[model samples]
Target: MPLLTNREIAETLERYANLASITGENAFRSRAFQRAADVVRDLHEPVIALMDRGDLRRLPGIGSGIADAIETLVRTGALPPLDALQRTVPATLLDLLQVPGVGVKTATRVYRELGVVDLPGLLAAAESGRIRALPGLGPKTEANILAAMEALRRRTGRFLLGTALPLARRIVADLQGTLPAGSSVAISGSVRRMEETVADIDLVVSTRVHEAIPATVAHLPLLSGIVRHENGSLRVTTHAGIPVDIVVVDPSVFGTALIRATGSADHLALLPEVLPSAPTEEEVYSRLDMEWIAPDLRLGLGEVMQAKAGTLPTLLSVGDVRGEFHAHTLWSDGTATILDMVRSAAERGYAFLGVSDHSRALGVANGLDAARLAAQRQEIEKAQRATGLRVFASCEVEVHRDGLLDFDDHILEALDLVIASTHSGLRQPRDVLTERLLRVIANPHVDIIAHPSGRLVERREGGDFDWNRVFAAAAATRTALEINASPERLDLNHDLARRALEAGCLLTINCDAHSTVGFDALEYGVAVARKAGADPDRIVNCWPIERIEAWLQTRQT
Candidate 1:
């Protein structure tokens, strides 16, 4: 029953369309498929449901041909035409389509003329002086391909943040149990920020058991591949195919160790500016007159500027978050029940929590309609009374293509909050999208816009919207913007958060958590907020219960 999610379908189609376009197969046909894929991926409702209702054709970008393809996939779980096309084309030629300078025609020519079926074949052809003879591909192009091939080999089997983060966490957990008492371990780098791709793994472990380093390294589970190990450091490949380096350091130096381990080389290079004479990593940030820059924000763009201006905003820390805004329960796609989600949030010392389950538009999420929403609300109210905690009832409502909300006005008004978002129709013209979002923000019931861009990082860049206008509308409407903590979708990206903050819009760092484990994703969101120069005071959820209640009430009245 778990067919490909809309996102997956869209991505596959987009890739195919791109390959087709680059190959000059049929520009219009390629564009048609690509646009349909984009629309399908962005739609809030399940594409399968739309197909079933004969509404797929009604969606923008979905013409008769694309609609037929979608219908076939929904019914058969495969696209026969796409499969046939793949069989007819060389997979290596398809891969070549991903290369920066390589085009589809070039790939086709290389395959047909030089017999380059794979990177190895391509490399061999370039080196054997056969590729340079091809039209449009000269010696310089050949050299470039060879160099790229080398880099590709090195990156092969590498782990991206999505894969590496979980493995790193498991390793840290295992190390904590085996290391001497009082030892601490944490993951650092882009993994910490929930970035999509990661170059390497950097871990900081604090332990008094120096003698146990080798044993710890040797006994580590998930080490399917090992690269090398030396000193108090061991570099190994995880079962997930990522290279990780675990560094064991003294507990007293844990903070400094973390700073050094989490460094983006470029960000570290600027350290001397703040600490012209200071010797240690910890001293560098302190000397620069700023708190230590979190590893995720070490992109080297404005850390120096903020330090010099002494106007760096106070970033949200784990303690600053007062509630969980986006969560799921047994009512929808979540694994936990409503009470369980509340209890878990309470354990984290949050003053309040918002349960914003998916609305009926998201059939894949088992989204709740009016009946289920009302039943869930009653149950939540009962849980709130028993637990003596405030639970805000909300829904992650989908904003339809026509610039309207998923739920009726009555349902929206009945909720404590509404996180209006675009789940579909993402390929709309830029102005149309802006107007759509603006209309949602202006809705009295909607409080925040979740994962504004809907990007899945590395996999796809979400639709581009007018940020200045969006922020302006948000500011005027008093609606907050979400910095989704899901490592895969850190929407309202750090840079955008900074712009939103400057524009005087309130911001919320929510886990958009679907389970108890997801509730802990707050750390990732906080890191993103900090990187964007977000101030704790400007964050709506950071406010105390009375203030938060007041803010929500303001939206209501």
Candidate 2:
């Protein structure tokens, strides 16, 4: 079979999305396709390999049908069902979704209501004032539609970090395996800096021979085509449509090339000096008379000045986290039981675990009522004795639009911790949402917020709250914000996490673990934390048992 990338698999899932959207199928059915696409698109390994290893089902969004479709695509390079779906949906109408404001529903509505089947048609409709007169759309939406169409025209080819990082790692690993024994390769550019999106992956290499590297890269398992192969650099697209650039130079110039490649253009402008013959980034920084700035801090965002001033933060590391919080069990929507969750946290060497199952408001999650909460406390006490791990029986209480918590005050005060958050009404107006969040954060019983933004990457946008105001209220109330690492919800993304920290707000980087294996996602939170310049001293969960206990006492009634 020819080389097949995960991109091919993702495209097939998209077809399902198109079909369901046009036919007005339920949201769940269309979302399955979108979710599956997200999983495959962000996956670092080729889908074909996962299919071969029988590991497809372990992924979050892949079910049996999607897995079968992936296998079919890998084996035959096409899916018959997807091809058929494409036939019903006009290709031009589907293309309208490429514009910024036009979603599947909006595109379908325009196509049906106004016979606007493409970008040009949609633009004409908006320009002629026909779009604003449609049932759901108004002037504001029409203006956005026109602007988004223009933005789409100007948009460049860039992959979201969630989609590109995994694939980039796989490609570099493949190159490392194929390169000559003494060759050295390191990722450069936005990937190294952990940008949310990037146009391409850049790699810097030092090898015994120059031509040998490109020839070797061309034959990597995922490589299907080459764009350019030059004396110093090579550009190629993986079978998954991820573009990569590899730059090879003599060992002496390797460090210089690396600094050049890892640059943000502006950062490189700060120093015309280059360090050659250095094997690592540390040496480059040392030669330039500065501390080694972390790659995430190399965004030319005043990091150089801080590096020179010796005030750069000692960022948090994976080893710093001492507890697990915001987890779930069978008491709520989670699949794991309380004991299983406790044991899993214990295995990871966590000193404490906060089991915050959902409150009774979320019917779908099987959220616990006050009686169920009291019973859960008994189980938690038993687990603490059995596992010898600190167990904090808690509830992820939902805050209603009117600023009321799911549980009463007495119930909330009795718990070890209260994680207040918004589960519904995410699309409320900014002032209303911010006020409700402020009301929750100020509650003496509330200790933390889970997935503060309520955003799911690639699936949903974050709520439109005034983050600065929320951060201010949180700082005053001593409410710790969360850096949720669900992959789908890396909320308070690195950027916002950094801003919140600067605003004197503390944060907890949590896996939001739903199952035993979900503990592995803890590292993703730590990555987001480090990228935000967060330090162990400020991350509540990274504190020692003594500090955590003392802090808990300050907040607990």
Candidate 3:
């Protein structure tokens, strides 16, 4: 059986859960699968290893049934329950669920009552005013469906960076063993550049035996089938349906070939037509009298010019990050307890960790009320004393639609860190959204604005804000804007991060972790900062604990 990553397994389980819901299966059963999917997705270890140890059900939400289903999926690459449902439910209904507002209930309603089976049919019905006339749905719901479908259409063919990167790394790791001693292998193209979404995976391999490369990859368990094989390149499909492109080149011109393959078409246009052969990318850049550009910054957006001018900013790296501030614990929806979370941070050699659970307004996340928040502080104090890690008390306070914060001013002042974020009403008009964020930024006690855009990659669009006004307000207040490192929501993405830096705003790169393994996403956040040409000095969380504490103290006063 081909190896399945945790994400792939989680996605399979989630699909089964969604299918069950659409088919009117038992609600508790479907939720069990869904919750199990969430647990598996956040896990740092491979699910197969746990299964090998007969401990798959040891996970929080996994029961005997879900464990069996996972084992069946890992072994056979199919879920019997999901297959059964596909026979009864129109598979197109699954596509309908992909729309933002169309949940299982809504999807079932439309398919059974309105006879709407897919996006096109739904769009047609909405345009014809048939959907609003349904028993429960209104004109507002129809408009929302139309808008969501339009947004969904724009996101086709792209896979999240979170999904594509790990798979590429896995493939590259497997292929690395096949290479001769001195040969090289690496991920390239957009995946290397750490783009938010990717159309396909690209790899560069340097070897003496080009033909053997294809023979080796052909046997990779991850590959479903080889799409095409040529003299210098090969294409294959994974079981999860992502495309892979591999380029093999002679060792002599490996660097040249890699630079060519790792291009943004526009970035390549700026280079000399005929490139010199070199053994390393650094040498290639040296021959061209330019600095070796980090892959994330090779977007052809003045980077080449900056390279020539010797003016490229020193970019932040994963190692430069000292700690994470926007993390959750058992006080909220997170699985890990405060002690476990602090221990994980300490194990990572972090000088400090912040326990920023969700505030009262986000009840779905088990957001902490003032009393709960105060109680959690006792736990934080206990964890800090036990772990010898400086644990900061904090809250990811909600920014209401009307511009009020979830916590009162006095409550906010008592915390070591306060992160204000918008958890709902992201679709408000441009002025309203901008004003809402601006108000939060201007608040005296709010230290940082987390996930400024409130977007999930390929899932939903973010708020339409007057960024100029927002950035200006944040800069004026010395408020930090977060580069939320969750692969699903790399909010304040590279482009916006650059603009915020240009506007003199302080930035923070946080994992916004919900579990211990969640801290692994810090690399993605650092990549965002690097892509924005941000220096380590500009990121608040990159500071030493003493400096960070001083800054927090300043904010409080």
For model 3 the local lDDT of residue 43 reads: 68
| Local distance difference test scores for all models | 0.76, 0.81, 0.87
Q: 187, model 1: CA deviation in Å? A: 5.0
lDDT of 1 by residue, 1-557 (tens): 44555656776677677656655567888888888887875565556567678888899778888888877776777766567667766655667755545666677688778766666677678889898898778876776666555545544433445557766887788877877677777887657655556766778777788777766665665453346766778776554345678777887666666666676767778665333333344565676667655556677777767766766555668897888778888888899988989999999998788998999989999998999999889988987987777999999998888878889989999999888878666656789988888889988889999999876554335666898999998998889999988877878778888899999999998888888988866776787788787888988888988988888889986
User: What is candidate 1's CA lDDT for residue 104?
Assistant: 62
Backbone clashes under 3 angstroms, per model = 6, 1, 0
Off by over 4 Å in 1: 1-163, 172-189, 192-196, 204-218, 228-234, 246-261, 273-280, 283-297, 305-313
Could you give candidate 3's per-residue lDDT for residues 229-279 as a string of tens digits? 877899987655678999989888888888888898888999999988987
Worst 10 residues of 1 by lDDT: 273-282
What TM-score does candidate 3 reach? 0.85
TM-score of each: 0.66, 0.78, 0.85
lDDT (C-alpha) at residue 532 in model 1: 81
lDDT of 2 by residue, 354-380 (tens): 999998889889988888999999999
Worst 10 residues of 2 by lDDT: 271-280
